[model samples]
Target: MADSYMDFTSPNTQFTYTLSDNPFFQKDAQNVINTLSINQLNTLGNVSLLDIFLSKDNVVEPHIHQNATELVYCITGGAVVSLINPYTKELLNFTIAPGQVANVPQGWWHYEVANQDNTHLLAIFDAPVPEVIFGSDILRLTPANVLAHSYCLDEAKVKDTLAPITDTVIIGPPASCSKQHPNGMPMQQMMNHGGMNMAQMAPGSYQQAIQNQTYHYPYRPISGESESYNAPLDHPFHPIPFLYRRWD
Candidate 1:
């Protein structure tokens, strides 16, 4: 019988799809990623997923999925999913272990850092293909002078530092880098590290900052600002849109 309701492709003819066969992207030896989407399974074109494997301290660099909301499930070990809430203007960090999940709204800047070795995660997306903007790309693509002027940063320093980021860093802080913080954490934390449940913040403090447009964390307050705060709000490490040219 010809079914008018759907295409006549036979599901039985299509062999079982394996995640291992789909290679989306990867980093060094410590990080591996597998992707699944409409490209592989036509039946589930509206949804997509990423299988990520990382060693201790490895990071899925800060980026934004312009097209889809991501739901990340921790399959093994531990990790910290960090993102900013646009509505509250509050930085949120969730510690995720096996059986835990974290969600990142579409177009939000976010990143994941593995807290332990053999960390595995599955990131499911609402779209078939997720368009992303990596923080490293934004930093490298934008002219140093533009960034220096916009954020009042020194031009020379910006150029010298970002010169190394020539490509989209899928996973970062390579295992070879020996840099460490005084507390024994890797240098990854140097880029706006946030903690879960900021207890030191007084009640209504974040709300007030959101109202006044005076939330200052990593950067000094703009001139004429008396109230200053030093919270996890300093996440310039995340990707932000920068239009270089207009498409006609």
Candidate 2:
């Protein structure tokens, strides 16, 4: 009988990994991700993973995976997974605890936030190499005039806000940020200035909010079309389009 482990001619076909062997990104010594992809595991063909570790209120910055879908499983602590569905153009959010999971479709913009200390989540992808576009790059690289004209934003403010993002920040709220939140406000306040009142809500209420909250916006065209043909006049797209809550 031939020994099952005796094939060594191709020394590069690795079958195991120490995920922490490489650091994907880290911020303020509080949040970090150890990414494993085709670059690290030559034998990997259809899948990869990110070992995410985040402290309380820490966030994995908004990003898009152009090549694959992501399945996130929580191993410890709690977190909120948020994504924007481009098709429906609504922002969706989910809160997950240990033993729960969330899925983000390919090419959708998404982010994750840790709700408790020592949060650990595994982000699995369907492609061997999941190509990513971080929001930091988009905010920093685009010409200010283009953004100002398209979004009707102030060019100077756009440039000033994004000037500090010189590097790709996978974990965000850079350590140098000085906009302090007085008192113990909910972490969502840090994400948006008009914070949701989550500090006094029960966990169940929070989950309900995740399940029911939907962002509604008026439809506007980007091209020469008058209105979207398949959409209704009042609310053209689906209201609650993209979020999937796996468990409680």
Candidate 3:
């Protein structure tokens, strides 16, 4: 009856039991079951393991997982995950089917919009506390004055968006959930975040198709003191070359 067992005592405590002891772990968990306590899961870095049998009408709103990468595996049903990278103005959307996987990068805003009917889904993450940097948790958990002073946003604005600050739970009342960016961070404004994407990249910008010359410089000693000049790869020094090019 128990494929695996975990005791979810709270947000940071747990006891673990495994079924097959398989390192890769098991997929298609609907036929079997396993559970882990919250404390045991705190050691889990950026992830939520879901065994969901979605009904005819199920919905997960637009949200971002803070400080973690999202890897969702569709077990019995497929889903449409939406993502927008504002800085680059690039968008990568998906409608993955059963047995397929979707990867969402860390700290970038994203959401998964499921199908119209029932489906089974499994979500994996790269963190133990999945919403450590999530918008809702940030808006709901921390003290407004502390966050406002740190972020440099107006305390009144922070208060309006993340009202009634308290520790946010993964599964909690919908009323407490806050917006992804209360100021409404639309895709067009993504450029402000400095996020990278294809649209923002100029064509052939990094292509090695053209040849370019690089210069290395030799530094003169300060009378008797030796010094080393360490330069970065993207740019180099060439003051000496210019000084002597017209000397002869």
Per residue, candidate 3 scores C-alpha lDDT tens digits across 1-248 of: 12134344556443343522312212223222222223344433333454444432233333565445777778765666667776887766777788898887765666554453456566666554344233344344345666677789788766654443232222211221221233455322232244323223334331211112112223232233334334321122311111100000
Candidate 3 weakest ten by summed lDDT: 239-248
- Per-residue lDDT of 25 in model 3: 17
Give TM-scores for every candidate, taking all chains together and pairing residue i with residue i.
0.71, 0.70, 0.40
Which portions of model 3 show Cα errors greater than 4 Å? 1-38, 41-48, 132-248
**Residue range 77-144, candidate 1, lDDT tens digits:** 88889898889998788889999999999989899988888999999998866666667567765677
Candidate 1 lDDT score relative to the true structure: 0.65
Q: Which ten contiguous residues of candidate 1 have the minimum total lDDT?
A: 213-222
How much lDDT does candidate 2 score?
0.66
Over 133-234, each residue of candidate 2 has an lDDT whose tens digit, in order, gives 667556644566667778998877666555545545566555543223445665655454333343443433433432332222233222335433443311
Clash count for each candidate, listed in order shown: 0, 0, 23
User: Cα RMSDs of all predictions?
Assistant: 13.6, 13.2, 21.3
Candidates' C-alpha lDDT: 0.65, 0.66, 0.42
**Cα deviation in Å at residue 35, candidate 3?**
8.0
